[model samples]
Target chain A: MECSVARTLDVIGERWSLLIVRDAFYGVRRFDDFRADLGIARNVLADRLGSLVARGVLERRQYEARPPRYEYVLTPKGRELLPVLLTMMRWGDRWEADDDAAPVTLTHTTCEHETTPVVTCAHCAQELSWGELRTDPIRVRIPAR
Target chain B: MECSVARTLDVIGERWSLLIVRDAFYGVRRFDDFRADLGIARNVLADRLGSLVARGVLERRQYEARPPRYEYVLTPKGRELLPVLLTMMRWGDRWEADDDAAPVTLTHTTCEHETTPVVTCAHCAQELSWGELRTDPIRVRIPAR
Candidate 1:
């Protein structure tokens, strides 16, 4: 459970949490929009949003003073979760979507080319596929008695 | 709700689900191994494993005939989830772990280098950092009513 993946999941592992973050990436900022877009129950949406804000994945910014209405936006920490969402999207596109179409297509705005994103080694910059990568046994630093 | 990411999450979004899959990736195949490694309660573990098997993410193989002992292994579909887990691990390393250490070290076995995996555009092979990507409004193909 000390693993980083587990830790990251600790903050955003709830059922509706990552979807809310994904909606934020799509520029859906308001509570009503998130609720409508996700088709999530109201209380569930509220809870997920509150937990996301509490976890620093999203922050509330007031846009109305009369009723003190607010919208949520991704924090710096949340925005950095792009890869996590993207990879999931890519996996979904590959495994879950119809063969002819993906529900969402990712566009690299700078290159202006639409494409699937991939994982590559930071050092060699080679695209890593299954069977190309391996893990060494993790060495626990606990003191031996 | 019909989005691929949502569909993918439908398969693996439950609490401890991905961790169970993570344990599978680490070669923890036997039930006791998964239970000991995850510290998950037996009932919860059994439920998750059954769901994983039913959903095609994992499959059970009978290893002993006398008492019908079984072990789980990732299927091709499950194995394709590599990027999703890698990105999560990378995010944890950067955000959750201390500057000096990460709990797990990923190695590019083919390249034989110790490194972090990053996301890149499949088309341009350019490293995609934050803010370099953008999304177009998805064009729904539904026939106009």
Candidate 2:
């Protein structure tokens, strides 16, 4: 199988693809609703919806017959992507929010308190993110010159 | 600027880029260490290192004199990417980790308790992660559609 990160992005990173998924998370499942929320063209929304449904991230159910309304619901596989999307929202909140207030806030369902998420290393267990560490791989072992 | 999510990925999602950054977060700097940890190829690692340095995500500082060894350090700009990377790790832990013992775990610095981060929408005060919210652009007027 492809690397988890790459595979995940490959499925999610097609322009407007993530936004569509985001809408599903928000309970906007109708084609028109997705179109309206994203300001995306009908054709693009149609294509994304079809692809997402095909990918098993979404399940389509017919709710109306006259106009044939359908709703998109997240499967376990789709729900699994929540962390990735949350990461994006956090990033947007930190860097893109126009004010002191976060563009989004995360609350623990159990404790019901506003909280911040952190990343730590498995080895040293340091809080990691951008500036916490440094990395690069070099080739050609240098001989004592 | 570009859509916040897309722009964020552009910075974090170059091939093997996030992993390299992940290593950095682990305090693995220098060429050989990264090579050892990631098993990345020479050329690919080299390219990623160069690009990250150029993007101001990392800085090259000589650590030795005889052969002039160098180590990559995270800049403030790079430091800001922490939350995003943390989110990614959280996602990986949830969806990708195989055992109950996740590849990594998050701990709240202040509370000193293992915790999970969440993303909530700014406008609605609803958690955006876990497929709970969707974004609305106010209108469906396509820019490039």
Candidate 3:
């Protein structure tokens, strides 16, 4: 489908794109910062940065003159991606980590509790992690190539 | 960094991969179901399914004999991906959408309200959105290739 969601994912779905954006969320704005934070190759970093700038997710601003260095700042589009990144962080925190360092601890502002976000069904209003959801009966087939 | 949070993203940062997982959460378990719901190319879907199965997120079980039909079901590992998908849907529904046809809607069980599952600060518990977050002053940099 040519939906905006699909379109947006097309731009950001590549290997290191979201992680680069995550670095931006962490306040690593420069090209060098992203390269450092991600350990991504310079070419890959340059390409992803170029794509983000093209998509209006980021804008390149000169940070230095003689050295010809630039910093990337989040545009409204890029800033809009925080929720996605946060969600990834939340998931990574829960399922991927070992005992020593938890990925992140999301603190609740109103309840004063450090918590992870849960998805509740809009229909049932139940917080469903994994086991809570049942299969919907309607099924479709993937066409053979 | 060697953190799993970083590591997990390395595995699942693709756009279609996450979308496939999201469809699974909606109870779309079969290959055909994913193909129809996502409108993804057959080859890409095949590759993604194979990758997910190999990674232990999904399992392929033969359901029919003559035609050798198979169904893709989420394993516990795949089921654990629900929160991550929920967070993405929640974000898309909020800052990204232009109108009432939101990316997705969620339900909360405690109050039985079909409210948006917002990411609030773990400390104050106030609903946090992308526009609200600022960078932590501490700059954590990893290696760059």
Candidate 4:
């Protein structure tokens, strides 16, 4: 549980939380739109939204003053999650999809082409495959409580 | 829900499922090791393991026959999830970790250097940032039921 991955899961590990982030990436901002797009119960959606905002992944912004209406927008931290979602989508498209085209394609605006994302080493810039990577245990300098 | 991300979530969406996969990457193969490391309910661990196997993420192998002992190993499909897990861990290390060093470091075996993974477009090989990509809806031909 002390692992970074475990800590990450502690924040946005639940199905509904990740799905909410996915919906936000799709430009879903309104409560009704999120509920309709996800078919999630109102209470569940509200709770997840609250947690995401509290966790600093989503920020609540007021879009209307008279009705006191607001929308949830992805924070920088939440926006950084695109790689995680995109990688999962790539895996699903490769392994889980039926014998049909992917339901959505990601276009790299910089390159003007549809793209599949691959993980690369930041230092060497070599594309990583499963066999090319290994984990080394590092001593975590735990602070005195 | 028809999107690949949704489908991927349907398979490994649960927190425990992904955690179990994470542990497998860290070389926790035995059921007891997983139970101890995760501190998860026995029934929940068993259920998630069963689902992962059924979903082709993990393969069960009999390591001992006398008492019918088995271990779960990641299949090729499961190994491909390294990017997803690595990306999440990187996010957590960057944003969620306390004032401590990362608990583990990934090394690229080919280059013999510590690695931070970045998502890169397979076509152009450019590292993707949040604003550099956009999703476009693609028609998936639904199979006749």
Candidate 5:
């Protein structure tokens, strides 16, 4: 895929893949815990976890050696997806959920204040809405596939 | 179902659905233009467009009466997803693209500075890392279906 957004979607666009990542963010590690929280089929969960690990978005660590228990943990690359998930949650709270029924409120521990995330310019730190930003793309002509 | 991320994903999580949205953002409105850019099958594109219009993410407008031409435009609800797309694109440019080969560069029009997006705390304006945030979610016990 020539487009960066499409490439990103290829990795984690599915509902299940994202939900798995969400669970991992909330400290769900063991397979059983993921299953418990997600109510996901065992085979499907295994498949998604395996793919995430292969893509380096997650890692499998042997937490117990007696019976060889392995737990999934987000890798550095996986942690970079935080903003994507945060923005998605904010969109849902505003659009889908009933008024005053936001399922979660995020608190910034560094600031000791409750906050939502705002996407801002990396250089100037101005908050970016759709109209404020313009893309000057280096257009690579991807052959129509 | 109780999770907002999952709920938002329910609306636009599929790869094709998102790609269609991406095309819309890039000013692709007519069906033929979207099909040309994405090379998506006609049936699939039509189905996704219909669903988006039904969900109020997109609205259809008739531009020509003689030949009956219609175009799809993002609604305000849909435009609000700008942050999510920005974050996703940034992540992809960093992780998926070859180093220094970013497909697009975004400019903050007001600042006249080219920048990438940074996710920040809405309250304190500090840049957010995954570790800096804590969630106090109102956990609604959803029955595992």
Candidate 6:
């Protein structure tokens, strides 16, 4: 797809993929840990992990040599997905959570405050909401069939 | 399921659901329009639209009366998902896009500059990155078996 959202979804759009990435952020590196934490089927987890690695989101490193064990770690590209996941968590906490309190809270290490992630304009640094932004179609290049 | 990100994924984690929402941000309203844009299966699109409407993200409003035609519009809750979508787009552009230029750019209407959305701590307004944030587990309530 030409749209960036579609392209991103092509890589990590599925619930399992994002959930696995979430688990990775939680520092669940071993395959068994991901399967245990997510309760995902072994085949599905394997497939997602393989795809993520192939897509350069996760790096597979041999952690043990005797039994030939591997661990999945987020690459730089995968680490950059933190904002996407953080924003989703914030949205879910606001709209989907059962309780008033967030199940988990993010602490900004630099400022030492319980923080809510807000999307801000990189140029003016203004916190942006839906109303404060407009889409500027820079160029729409129709893909050649 | 306890994680808000997982909860949010329970709602819109599917690729098609997010694609439809992305199209909504692009001002797509009609069923035909969504179908035309995404080339998604009609039944799947119908199912997704129905679920989104049921979830209060998209509202179906009567736009034509000749044969009871309706258009899907983003509700306040749906509009709140813009940041989620924007962050994903930003991530995709950074990693997935083959070209340097983004297919579309968001302009901060307040600042009138092409903007990149950055996640920031709401309290101190400092730009947040993965290393600068730490996840604190508040509480985990076990579900009754």
Worst 10 residues of 5 chain A by lDDT: A136-145
Which candidate would rank higher by TM-score, 1 or 4? Answer: 4
Candidate 3: which stretches are off by over 4 Å?
A2-5, A64-68, A98-114, A119-145, B36-43, B65-67, B93-114, B121-124, B129-139, B142-145
Preferred candidate (TM-score higher): 1 or 5? 5
Give RMSD to native, each candidate.
4.1, 7.6, 5.2, 5.2, 3.4, 4.0
**Per-residue alpha-carbon lDDT of candidate 4 for residues B1-145, written as tens digits (9 for 90 to 100):** 6778888888887789988898787677889888877889999899999999999999999999999999999999999898888899899888888885645788899999999999999889988876788778632222223
- Candidate 5: tens digits of C-alpha lDDT, residues A21-126: 8888888788988888898999999999999999889999998899999999999999999999999999998888866564688889999999989999888888
The residue pairs in collision within model 6 are none
Best DockQ among the predictions, by candidate number: 5
Off by over 4 Å in 2: A1-56, A60-73, A76-83, A89-145, B99-102, B120-145
Q: What lDDT tens digits, residue by residue, belong to model 3 across residues A71-113? A: 8888877876765666666666666666685454544434545
Each prediction's interface RMSD?
4.4, 7.8, 5.3, 5.2, 3.4, 3.9
* Better model by lDDT: candidate 4 vs candidate 6: 6
- C-alpha lDDT score of every prediction, in listed order: 0.82, 0.62, 0.65, 0.85, 0.86, 0.86
Q: For residue B29, give model 3's deviation from the true position in Å.
A: 2.7
State every prediction's TM-score relative to the real structure: 0.88, 0.58, 0.72, 0.91, 0.92, 0.92
In the predicted model 1, the residue pairs found to clash are: none
Of 1 and 2, the candidate ahead on TM-score is 1
The order by descending lDDT is 6, 5, 4, 1, 3, 2
Q: Give the per-residue Cα lDDT of candidate 2 at B14.
A: 58
Q: TM-score (0 to 1) of chain B, per candidate?
A: 0.87, 0.79, 0.75, 0.88, 0.90, 0.89
Worst 10 residues of 4 chain B by lDDT: B136-145
Worst 10 residues of 5 chain B by lDDT: B136-145
How far does residue B45 in candidate 3 sit from its true spot (Å)?
3.0
Error of 2 at B47 (Å): 1.1
* Candidate 1 lDDT, B1-145, residue by residue in tens: 6677787888888788899888787777888887777788999999999999998999999999999999999999999888888989888877788666646777788889987888899888888865777655662222233
Model 5 lDDT per residue over B1-114, tens place: 777898899899987888888777777788988888899999999999999999899999999999899999999998888898999999998889866564788888899899
